[model samples]
Target: MRAAVVGAGPAGMVAADRLASGGAEVVVLEATGAVGGRTRSVLLGPGHRLDTGASWLAGFYSEALAYCSGLAMLRRDVTGTPQLVVGGRRYPAPFEPGVLARSPLLGPTEKLRFARWVAGVLARRRRPHVGPPRRADADRADRIDADTAIREAVGAAAAEYVLRPAFETMVFADLADLSAAFVEGWIRAAFDGRYRVPAEGMDAPWRRLAARLEVRCGVEVTEVRPQGPGGGVVVEPVGTFDAAVVAVPAPVAARIVPPGVPGRPAWLGELRHAPHVLAYAARPHPDPPPASDVHPAGAGRHRVGSVALYPGGDGRVPVGMQGATVSAEGWWSDELLAAGLDDRALAAALWDEGRRLEPGLFGLEEATVLHVARHPHAVPVFGPGHLARLAAWSPCPPVALAGDWTCYPCVEGAVRSGRRAAEVLLTAGR
Candidate 1:
């Protein structure tokens, strides 16, 4: 069997790998000059490289972890307590043990209410899985927005000061725009408390996988259409294959897959995405660095949404220098994109925000901007009804869809979607 995989992102790469392993000849086509898609790493300086995109790997990312099994990994020590900056004051992250009891961010009555709400969620917690939730309770949870659920369960203060910031920092979208099921799944999955990154870069695993496949970079696939009854043909320098997986983003997929394809759902064009702008900078820091990670409560009030400081001697920066990545708030990123600001202007704006927000955090006054990464479709927003839409769609043989949008919006989701797509075609005997 001959298979064609479009896009070289994690989903496409994994799909190609699976098709080849299943005794099919596969060819992977990428639009850009490089692979990895949103998992890209950029060179900052002579000996400095930074992952401008998906940088952290959670313990629950089973598929992504398996892909990076033999590669060198660096575990980020969570022993250092993460800080939540609110109203110019720092408090322990809400997830930390004993934080709810001691944090001044909540009143005595509010703390009790928040604790009860959390206990309820924990009681219903189950192992996180890709795609829509299978259980009845989890499926119900997907019908409500996270913000509404939190506000109704606890109170406005807990939703504002505790949950919203943390969730937004992770997904780059407002809690009001997300589903409660997504939040619950994240809580269960991240409970393991193991976070790591590839020792080389976030893109290392994809690069490793691509090396074993017939990947053609800088090859754009304009269209994927059905050929005859059981096969598909990729246009723009056509190639016919028994099976094909379109693993690009939802919007891109809508454009590439013309009408008449059996599996092309109308909701594909309606999927929402969060925009992101990340500024990478480095500065000399003789003194100890502040918290390695900081999530700003009420991120809209600040220009920068979150900050992640690289550990000392991480090799991403020179000795005695600290590296950091500052992410612009979701709304702010939209403004920047709309204004058509260049990388330099964007970096300058983020630098100014970092200096104003946390003067002592990374010595921003002395920092030099290395690179600015912009993602128009940084993350797929899993809002209410998203899961139901996914569950209702059925795959047609030989023409399958794969992306994080098909599952959850994370590395594991992307990998799992690819595997499922390949399994569909392989099982059909295409």
Candidate 2:
């Protein structure tokens, strides 16, 4: 059987791999010059490369971890005690009960309320599964926004200072813009395992996977149509295939996919995405450079969302110089994009915000901007009723859809979506 996979991101690449493993001829078409879609890593300097896209690999990313098993993986030591900055104060924000008891980020009463809420969510937590969540999982929480649920359960201070920053850093969207069901799932999944990154780079695994496949880069697929009953054709560089998988972002998929495709969602074009801006910088470090990552929220006039530090020991930096990637808040990133600032100016702005958030640590007066990455569709926002909509959607034989937007917004979601899409095609072909 012949298959075509569009968009060489994690989902597309994984689908191609699965199709090939099933003894099918597969061709992957990527619009960009590179593979690894949002997991892209770029050169920092002479002998350094930094991940400007998805950086950390959670313990729950089973598929991604298995795909990169041949490469050397380094356990990230910074996950143990991350710091959260709120109201110009820094507090240790680990998941430990003792740590939360002593933390001044929330009052005693608020902490009690937050703890009860967390316990309730955990008590009702279900086992981890792939694909979209079932409709049976929907409840009153699924109908409300995360911000409202959190604030009501655990006062405004706890919501703003503790929960909001941590979740926002993960999804790149404000709590008010997300569904309570999505946040609850993330809460249940949080701290399940340690965090790690590839010694080569975050994209190392995808690059290895791509090297073994037939990938055509710099090729834009204009249209995908069902040729007959169980066959499809790709328009640009037209070719007939037994099956085709559209693995790009939802907005792009909506534009390329013609009408009358089976199992296509009516609201595919209405999906929303959060914009992201990341600025990479390098400079000589002071003795014992900032070891803790900084997450700032609910602080007025703070544009920077988080500052992730690379302390040179990892392959992420040269010796004696610390590397850091500063990301702007989702809302602020939209504003930055609208302002139309040049790359240098944008990098400077992000760096300045990082320095202000951590004056003692990010005091790199002479830091050099390595690169700036801007993603217009960084992550899919799972607002109220979004998950239920996905639960009811499924792929057909000739044409299938696969992406993180089809599931949760993470590497795991992308991997699962690709595998599911390939399984559907393989089954139909048989």
Model 1, 17-122: lDDT tens digits are: 9989999899998988988998888776665778878888887788999999998887865643457788778787666548778888888988988878777777
For each candidate, how many residue pairs have backbone atoms clashing (under 3 Å)? 0, 0
Total clashing pairs in model 1: 0
- Whole-model Cα lDDT per candidate? 0.79, 0.81
Candidate 1 minimal-lDDT segment of 10 residues: 229-238
- Candidate 2 per-residue lDDT, tens place, 218-246, comes to 99998887877544665556577878998
